[model samples]
Target: MSAIIDFTTAGQNFQAYRAEPTGVVRGAVLVIHEIWGLTGHIKDVADRFAAAGYLAVAPDLMGLAGLDATLLAELGADRNDPVKGAAAQPRIREATAPLRSPESAARIRDGVKEVFNHLEATAEGAGRTAVVGYCFGGTYSFALAVDEPRLAGAVPFYGHANFTAKELAGINCPILAFYGEDDTALTDGLPALIVSMQAAGVDFKYTVFSGAGHAFFNDGNTQTYRAEPARIAWTETLEFLEKHVQ
Candidate 1:
């Protein structure tokens, strides 16, 4: 089952695409979108999680930045088209500019928490909700793992976050991160992050795929998709969620 539902958080109303499992649900998943917002690709990912016996919710966080579903969808289309995508860069940047402030990050986190609160209300979702995110969403995955002690686990794909050891120590759940060796902007910082995570005694595991770059799992963007790595990451992600979220 799938639907678009309205939710309120931080005094703002937002919509989320929800997918429910037909069989017994083993866990719940919060699917976070890339910078493109809650596009069809994200909806498809949520549906995939639902088919795998997990209730999945993908929130439109971009709405807080003044980007609606219609505009996000159009921007997403432009992002996937090489010719138009290049021309649409400025507009995309302008649209996302408002979300760069610390206040915006806090509001976004509140929205995520509200979604998690709803999931927690479910019988099978109480202590079994995991967060899976890509790109921009990945960064929030880390943030949530640190801020929300109720989270079961976190999966971040090619997302980077700078955290002091003190902040990292607040994470109570395990983290499973995926990265591409060629995604230097993020991968280059992995060693330092690893050190901080270890110093903080957090359970952090990661995988780096050779020949893959940023957004490797986003098959919607043909330019950066890596079939083999994405396949492996999907399998590993499912296994990790099954182990941690149950």
Candidate 2:
């Protein structure tokens, strides 16, 4: 079962959706949402992870203080409409702006720390733990792994890399990073980043899917959905988690 819970972190109350496995959990995973925040898609991802025999929890890292329902509604509504989707950019930016700031990132780190604390208190949290995210969430996943050493693994699907080689050195766990070959910004720096990670002795697996663009894993986005690559990515992700967490 999954429920919404509120916890205090960095002087603010953050909301999170936690999904527990049917019986004893093999491990715990912190699911992070995209730039749009903790929408239905993110919740669905959490539910999927729960079904996979893990205690999956997705925290509303956007502070959960002033979420505009109208904006959120538009975000979910425009998934299939490119014309309407363009209009949603500004709102999404506005929603995620707080997280872009260094101060806000620190707060989010604190929030994630609280989440880990709660998970550690659970029966299923004994073995291993991981963090996974999509798009913006992917970026946070990397940040969380760097900030929190307890994480057993980190997976970021098409997320922007915010940490440098120096910062990534702090990540003790393995990372499975997926990106799109067509993602301009990521494509440019990905090679060097991979090299740097290898040089720094960071255990990592990186894959770039051809003919797919950003947000390719999101089945909700008709324009960006590439069924084959998405499926492959999902399969690889599950396999990686099973090896590390279970």
Candidate 3:
């Protein structure tokens, strides 16, 4: 079962979804949402993790503003069609801008802390904890890894790549990153980033799924969905978490 909780961060109340196994949990997972916010897909992902015997929590980063699952899905849909994709960029920017703000950053930090608080407060959640994110959530997952030293692992899928060698050096856990070979914009700087992480002694694993462009894991996007690659990525993610968090 799942429920929502109000967490105070940066003086704002951020809503977060929590899911756990029927009985005791093996560990805890913080499931970050996509650019569209905490939609059904994100919730479903959390449920999947819960079913796998982990306590899963998905925080609504865009909760300050109101957005429904359908709208989030539409916003997250393929933007390859210049007309549709280009138009969606501004909307995405608007939706995501708050997260980058100073106030929003503090809120996100506190919000994530609240998740850990919830986990540490529970018997199942106290064992170990990890994080996994998609798209914007993927980027945030990296940030969470840097900010929270207690995390066991992080898996970021097709998210933004923005980390300096110095910042990467501070990460205390392993990271498994998934990217799309065809995503030129996001993948362009990945090689350098990986090199820097390696130089900084950060244990990082990266995979670029061939022929899969951005947002391949998003089942709502029929046009860009690569079922095989997504399935493989999911399998790898589960394995990575089990290996590290367990």
Candidate 4:
């Protein structure tokens, strides 16, 4: 039902977890991962999308963070340990520092576009396509739209915005962003971002789950997962996708 496949972007090889839908494909989606590369959680997200009747692919964008393939895999695997996962947080952040740099962002942008190409060329894609991501992936989902206006929609869950106003203005697709009220580190800047998105006349809508915090939808991370909010978020996401991409 799902498998890992390799694709090249920026002259570097990377692997992605791809899932095909059970019935007629309504659309294709590019699922981006959190800070932890192409971890199991992200693969699960792709599979969930597939279950909803869409071809989904989650790319290992950690490659743009300068992590070697082997080490990236090890780090992704280590995220399963309750202790090691906690201890690995700092290093994970360090490794992802490169993602904020222009060069890395450009590479990641090019890489995701190539993934879209692969999906359309081989995955029996629909005319409409969307991008959805969590945390780190969510940030990129927003950023991707800044440059890739071909997307049908963009959904970013609990990700901080880092794109410029000029870039945001370039996005033509509607954005349905999610956040948790308690995620200070991520939500603190939301007010300013809302102003910018409005000023740019971008079609952006955001919802902040009252009791949920960062990574609330991440069922694998018990410390952060909130079932009720996650379920609500999932339902909302599905409705959004159906309206925009299906």
lDDT of each: 0.90, 0.81, 0.80, 0.84
**Candidate 4 lDDT (Cα, whole model)?**
0.84
TM-score of each: 0.96, 0.91, 0.88, 0.90
Candidate 4 lDDT over residue span 38-134, tens digit each: 7778889899999998899999877765866566567655665776888777776666567768888788878888887776675455457889999
Candidate ranking under lDDT, highest first, comes to 1, 4, 2, 3
Top model number, lDDT = 1
Error of 1 at 107 (Å): 0.7
**Candidate 4 off by > 4 Å:** 68-89
Tell me the deviation in Å of residue 43 in model 3: 0.7
lDDT of 2 by residue, 192-217 (tens): 87888887788989889999989899
Model 1 pairs whose backbones collide: none
- For model 1, residues 111-222, the per-residue Cα lDDT tens digits are 9889988998997689999999999999999988988999999999988778777889999999999999999999999999999999999999999999999999998889
Q: Which portions of model 1 show Cα errors greater than 4 Å?
A: none
* Candidate 3 TM-score to native: 0.88
- Backbone clash pairs for candidate 2 read none
